[model samples]
Target: MQTLTGKTALITGAGKGLGKAVALALAAEGLHLGLIGRTQKDLEEVARQAKKANAGIEVHIKVADTGIYAQVKEAVSELVGLLGSVDVLINNAGILKVGSIVELPVEEWQQVIQVNLLGAYYVIHEVFPHMLAQKKGDVINVASTAGLKGAANMSAYGASKAALINLSESLMYEGRKSNIRVTTLNPSTVATDMTVNAKFTDGNVEKVLQPEDLAQLVVYQLKLPQRAFVKEVGLWSTNP
Candidate 1:
């Protein structure tokens, strides 16, 4: 396994759930964290906890909407300046709108696409140049199992994630020669507010895949040998 110590990773949606968990795990390995989230309070809280995990670990928090190009561009530029360079980019920010197509508000559907699909695009667009310039980096998009197929009341969310998976695939082929790894992870039944709302799981987090479970997997993927990388992977809850 490769050592990630002293590297830099930027994670979107880092305030809660898998984002927060991943940030902490990365901190444990001594990677400086550049966290992007919608809520400043949550971002600060995560940063605080991350600092506690390793006293010398650096945490930079940026409040920006990844769905917005201007915000993402500005936020990423500033973060890169703070951290020097981004070794890994995790596009984990997404929204779930669980309702029938007919019943779901048009605005909500648009919002889902904006945040889930467009958001990932904007972040990748901003960070790819850096990875390309360096000829080495990792880009992990946290998609969903729902994206793999059509499911009940998942029109907007499913469509967004499906597009994200395609996006990851295209980037994987496009960037592989440059030695930048682009991967997509589709996790099922994670015990987060999003999954609980979808009624796929409950508050008993341990009975299903927890946020840290998904977070740890992403870290493991990042540590693989430079000569080998998984293009895409999926996670499912065995008990669920």
Candidate 2:
């Protein structure tokens, strides 16, 4: 296993849910953190927890909406300034608008794409140059099982996650020579606010995958040896 001491990680949507859990887990391993989220209060809370885990570790919080390119650029710049250099980038900001293609509004679909797909792109684009210059970095993109399999009433959300998977693959190809690793994590039915109200085809909320479990998996990946890279991991609950 590799140690995370002296490393810095930037995680988007880190104010709550899986992002928050991952931040705490990384901090436990001695990684400094940059928490990016729209909610200032939530970001502060996560930062507090992360600092508690590692007293010497630095924590930088930035309130930025990942869907906006300018905001994402500014946030990345601020994070780099505060933490020196970002060693790991976690693209976890996304939204779910469950609707069939026939009934889904164009605006709603666009909003999902903007946040889920384009948002990841904006972050990666801003951070990749620095990673390339450094010749070493890690990117972990939080996708969904919808990216691998199409489900009913998930046109927008599924399409966006699928795009993220493709983007991660493309990034891996580009960064191979530079020793930068790109990983895509596809999980099903994580128990978060986003999934709490989500109804399946049978009108039941699937609560099999928890945020902490997802966080543990991400931390495990980060602990792997530098020469060993798990490019893509697909996780699903047995009950789901």
Candidate 3:
């Protein structure tokens, strides 16, 4: 197993939920962290916790909306300068707007696509050169089960995630020669703020996935050997 002791990881949506869990998990393994989120306070809290775990580890926080290309580019540039280079990139920032196709507003649809799909592209584009220069890196896209299977009232969210899955596949093709590993995780019903308000068919939340479990998987993938790559993995609660 490859150790993460000296690596630096850049994670988006690091304020809470799956992102925060994954950040802390990587920190536990002695990885430096570069956290990006829309809220400075949340990012700082995560950084504080990470620093407490490993005092020698470097932590950088950037408050930039991933939806904007210029901001994403600028943030990545600054992060590379601060952390030397990002050894791992996690695209975890996402939004959900549930509505049937006929009832979905155009703006809502666009917003979902903008944040979930275009945002991933922006980050990948900005970070690709750095990974190429280093000739090795890990890119994990936090997709959803909605990406693989359509659901009622999830047209917008599902479409965006599906695009991400395809994007990750394409990235693997382009980055394989450079020794960059691109993996996508499709988790079903993670228990987060995003899912707390979601309208479940039977209002059954107990069967949903847990952020900590997903975090464990993220850390496990990070530790995998360079010769092997799990391109895409789907996770669902057995009870769900």
Candidate 4:
């Protein structure tokens, strides 16, 4: 396994759920962190916990709404400057809205697309140059299994994630030449606040996947030697 000790990682949606778990896990592995999210307080808390995990690691936080291009651009630039360089990018920021097509408002549907799909694109667009210049990097797009097939009331969310899956694959092909590994993760029914609030998993989280479970997978994938990489992963809970 390649040690992540001195590398720096920039994670979108780092305020909670899988992002927070991954940040703390990476910090324990000695990676400097740049956490981006809309909430300043949540980001600061994550940063504080991360520093406790690795007293020597540098952890920086920025407030950015990934759905907005200007915020993403400014936040990424400032974080890249603070961390020195971005060795890994976690494009995990996303939103979910549930309603049937006829029942779903047009604006709400577009909002989901803007946040879940365009948001990831903006982050990658800004971060890819840094990775390309370095000739190596890892990019993880935290999509959802909802993209694989459609569900009754999840049209907007599914469409957004499906687009993200396609985007991640294209980037994976293009990045291979530069030694940058791009992996798309499609996880089903994680017990995050999003899922619980959406009522996707009845709050009986122990029976389904958890944020830390996905975080462990993220760590494993990133730890693989640079000579090899996993292109995509679809994770499901056996018990669920």
Best candidate (score: lDDT)? 4
Please provide, for model 3 over 1-240, each residue's C-alpha lDDT reduced to its tens digit, 9 standing for 90 to 100. Answer: 999898999999999989999988888899989999999999999999988878888989999999999899999999989999889999999999989998999999999999999999999999888899999999999998899988889999999999999999999999989999999999988888888877642366566787889999998898999877889999888874
Please give, for residues 50-154, the per-residue lDDT of candidate 4 as tens digits.
Answer: 999899999999999999999999999999999999999989999989899999999999999999999999999999999999999999999999999999999
Better of 1 and 2 by TM-score: 1
| Model 1 per-residue lDDT tens digits across residues 152-211 | 799999999999999999999989999999889999888887777767675666688999
Shift in Å, residue 70, candidate 4: 0.4
Clashes per prediction? 0, 0, 0, 0
128 Cα displacement, candidate 4 (Å) = 0.1
lDDT of candidate model 4 versus the reference: 0.94
- The lowest-lDDT stretch of 10 consecutive residues in candidate 2 is 198-207
**Candidate 4's TM-score:** 0.99
Clash count for candidate 2 is 0
Per-candidate TM-score against the hidden true structure: 0.98, 0.95, 0.96, 0.99
lDDT score for residue 72 of model 3: 97
What lDDT is reached at residue 233 by model 3? 97
What stretches of model 1 exceed 4 Å from their correct place?
A: 202-204
Quick one: how many clashes does candidate 3 have?
A: 0
lDDT-wise, the better of 3 and 4 is 4
- Residue 12's C-alpha lDDT in candidate 3? 93
Global Cα RMSD, each model: 1.0, 1.8, 1.4, 0.7
